[model samples]
Target chain A: MRAALYQAAGDVTVGDVPDAALAEPTDAVVRVLRSCICGSDLWSYRGVINRPAGSRLGHEFIGVVEEIGAAVTTLRAGDLVVAPFQWSDNTCPACRDGVQTRCDNGGTFGAPGTDGGQGEAVRVPQADGTLVVVPGGPDGVDEKLYPALLALSDVAGTGLHGAVLAGVAEGATVAVIGDGAVGLCAVLGARQVLGAERVVLMSRHDDRAALGRAFGATDVVAERGEAGIEAVRELTGGRGVRHVVEAVGTPEAWDMALGMARVGGTIGAVGVPHTTPQLGLFPPFRQHLTISLGVAPVRRYLPDLIDRVLAGSLDPGPVFDLELPLEQVADGYAAMSERRSIKTMLAG
Target chain B: MRAALYQAAGDVTVGDVPDAALAEPTDAVVRVLRSCICGSDLWSYRGVINRPAGSRLGHEFIGVVEEIGAAVTTLRAGDLVVAPFQWSDNTCPACRDGVQTRCDNGGTFGAPGTDGGQGEAVRVPQADGTLVVVPGGPDGVDEKLYPALLALSDVAGTGLHGAVLAGVAEGATVAVIGDGAVGLCAVLGARQVLGAERVVLMSRHDDRAALGRAFGATDVVAERGEAGIEAVRELTGGRGVRHVVEAVGTPEAWDMALGMARVGGTIGAVGVPHTTPQLGLFPPFRQHLTISLGVAPVRRYLPDLIDRVLAGSLDPGPVFDLELPLEQVADGYAAMSERRSIKTMLAG
Candidate 1:
């Protein structure tokens, strides 16, 4: 089998790798249908998020189950599914509450030097928990929609869940504080699901902001921190946004998220948190506020999104502006690393 | 009029002061039926919260409307009322939304040389918004319960509102981070209104803990910060509390409040924010959480609490164990400061 492997900062390659099989009794092997480069992937490739040598490089995917362990009951060969970013025993108490990402047995995929997806064929541990059978059938949704469905595996679901967590409501004014695929999806979530009245995308470039508007953003503010705060307040009757979705994982982004919320409004954050060594958050509260943090449980959002797509009410597939053969993995990383594309879809 | 004046951080004394008259068109001059001390008052007494010399010393009180300005319509002369600590017009959007404490025209009593009600008379501004005409025709309920009614002015209502803001609900397990009048009152709020399944009172004092239990705290932990977090987690099956009322204002108290909540829990804080330099509340996202901050809108809560008292179904009067003559204003602070009293009721 061949898979994209990390080499050094700003570099990656498709190389021959060992065969993958069921690593655990609950595990299965999936023949990748579609995979994509994520903003989070840039964190590792840019050396911002440290990665071990020769690690597989993707976590988001939609695939067909090629094989299943004897212990797996719900999944079998020929089944099509979307794998959420986190692997969890969906039966755990946390998962039952729709927070599967924090499940006691929740597992992380695509870590450097570990066996993860992103290959031609990938081993999926806890198959029953990680993979969801895309109800209608494997061919129920077209292949072009697969990458967007692939996005739902992590990015889209994460973004939408972020907005949902932030209490984005119908007719609400929202400010999305990041410009990644997740942020764009949050804009979609805000408008399509939550029915936000207006979504203000905070971005610097024409490209990202364009994607933001296509997703549902009514306005765009190109400011970063303090200025962005002023821009949002100016846009919101001199108060602040009623709901704010923070999709970037940085202290600056966190500040912007908190600052953009009205005195009594909410800030929902979905940026994967980097442990702050100091164990501190500086000046986030201002009299009355509700600050919610953490990664969104993508699994919990899968059903509603799949329904929307199947119903043909919303098409989140436009984020896949570019597509490539899986073998040309190097160009995908370069384009995304240099901010030339919103996201890249890879064909199996 | 004679009242206790806040002259300096540590100097609050009974002295002759100018008469308090109608300060606004919606103002009313109240002949205070009863007045009392609050923990917020102690901040000025300790000089932790700076105030100009000669400010009045009390904010919580029940009174008879002695006079009303032409603009005052909802309240009139001889009408007995339990006025909230902050005078609100109750007509603003914030007030209409039931958060009168944060009303646009709100003004605080006992704020550094201002005419607080720990006196013969005090001016109630925004009378229609701030004063609640105690129900039962004002003549039916016993006047002796005035001290407890006075609590609706701030302490009890603030704590109760904090829990309410934090979404303490029926069958929820609550953790209160302070053991002062407000903290214990928060226990009452949780048990009575929220119907908490279990209440954890963080207290190191036997007397306070006993009072906490009486006030509806189902469990008590004699620990602070991390240890307190451990105790609460242990009590909630090692998951953490579903609701935490942070009645303590310090950063450490805020930390403990965050530490105590389970993922998807809520934290309501109404601890008269002083020395609010920063906040550290990131861990709850892996657990979902809602953190709401603000003092209770007493005017909104007073009518309900008065009903509870009138029905004889609830009694929080035990919290004010000591009753003192208004002349010995210093003793009220001393009793609470020295731990000799859980709450002091100053008779006017």
Candidate 2:
């Protein structure tokens, strides 16, 4: 099987690897149809997050089931499905409560000893609980819908999870920190799912800013730090926003998001933090702030987001600004790593 | 007039002081009928929180309005009232959002230049907004209700705020991480206001533990640190509780509370943090925990709490296990500081 493997910092290779196959009774093998580069993937590329040599890469993908374990009941061979970044047993208390990412016996796609998503084929654990069969069958689904359907695996669902965790409600004034794909999608979720009356996006790039506006951002703040907070406050009529989504996993973004939120407001953070940001207890205490921090339980939001995508009202497919063949997997990672693309979709 | 003033570390004096008078047009002077010692008050008494010489003390009181400035409306001179620990102009955006403690122009009771609640007469800013009028007139409100009414100014209201922020809903298993008056009251709030199905109080003291059970704590955990967490986990069938109220501001309590909460659960923090606790971004992010940290906006919950008190359904009076004359305010502080009493009520 051809798969993406990490070699060293700033280096990746698409080469022959052992084929993925059902290992556990709860596992299934998926033939990769589409996979993409995520912001977190850049962590290892930059050596900020160490990746061992020959490690399987990628955590987001949509594909067709090539084989199912005997124990798998819900999914069968040739079923089109979207896989959340993390696998969970649906019967766990946490999974039942819609926090599949924290499933008691769950694990991530690229964790040590597990098959990764960015491959020709990958073995999925707890296949019956982890894979969501797309409404349409594997046959004749619109090719144009790939990017949008693929987004349900992580990006779109993650953004919506931020909105939900922040308790974004009707007529809320929201500020979305970070203008990455997930941040832009959060702006969309704020407007569509949470009914936010206003969404301010923090962005310095012209292309991303334009994309943010198209995704329903009412205002854009290019300034960083205090100036950015002031800009958000200005847009919110001198009071900060009621809800904020922190999508960039940086200390600066976290601080700015906290400052951008109004007194008593909530900051829903979905960024996978690479740095240990210390939240000083005093300021947030005085402001009565709620910092809802964590990884997005994409599976919890997959059902609703899939419906929204299939309904044609949501076109988050634009997040994929670059596309390449599976053999050019290294190029896909480089494009996203160097900021040459918002996201790169890999066709198998 | 006489007032309780901090003379030095571990030293409080009941001495002559200038009478509280309505200076601002929005101010009202109230004759404090009942005042009580709070857990936070011990910080200064134990020299944990610095206090300037002759600084006025206390922030919880129920009183009778003696005089009102021309701009004061809604509150009359003879009205009986409960004053939240902070004063606010209710018209501010934060106050309108039901977070009065963070009102744009609000101030805490004992802040420099503000009249403290421990005095015989206290000048209250934003009288109409900060003071909740007790339903019955000043003439004949029952003496037995004074302690409960006094509880509303801070203790009971603050506990309820914790429960509310934690989003303790029906069928929730809640764990409160303290044995102080506020924590006991939090147990009550979890059962009464939040409708939590099970309430657990972390207490090592038999007396406090008994009071906790009376306040509706279904279970008690005397262990601290890992053992305490294991106890809670055991009670919840190894999943941890859905709602946690942190009434102790120490970092250890914070960590334990975080550990005790299930994934997707909330930890409502109401304690005045004596130490600057470092909440490292990673643990909370991975756990998907929501840390709702802040001082309780007691004013926001005053009306409903007062109503519950007046209706004879809620009695937080039991927390005040000792009573002292106003002249012995110093003694009341000493008793609570020495743990001789759960809380001490100061009577006029």
User: What are the per-model DockQ values?
Assistant: 0.44, 0.83
TM-score of chain B of each: 0.94, 0.98
The prediction achieving the highest DockQ against the true structure is 2
Candidate 2, residue A182: Cα displacement in angstroms equals: 1.6
Which pairs of residues have clashing backbones in candidate 1? A55-A113, B54-B113, B55-B113, B55-B114, B89-B129, B90-B129, B263-B287, B264-B288
How much of the true A–B contact set does each candidate keep? 0.37, 0.88
Per-residue error at A320 for model 2, in Å?
0.8
The lDDT leader among the candidates is 2
Candidate 1, residue B15: how far the Cα is off, in Å: 1.1
Clash count, one per candidate: 8, 0
lDDT of 1 by residue, B205-232 (tens): 8988998998888899998879889988
Give the Å error, residue A332, model 1.
Answer: 1.6
Q: What is candidate 1's DockQ?
A: 0.44
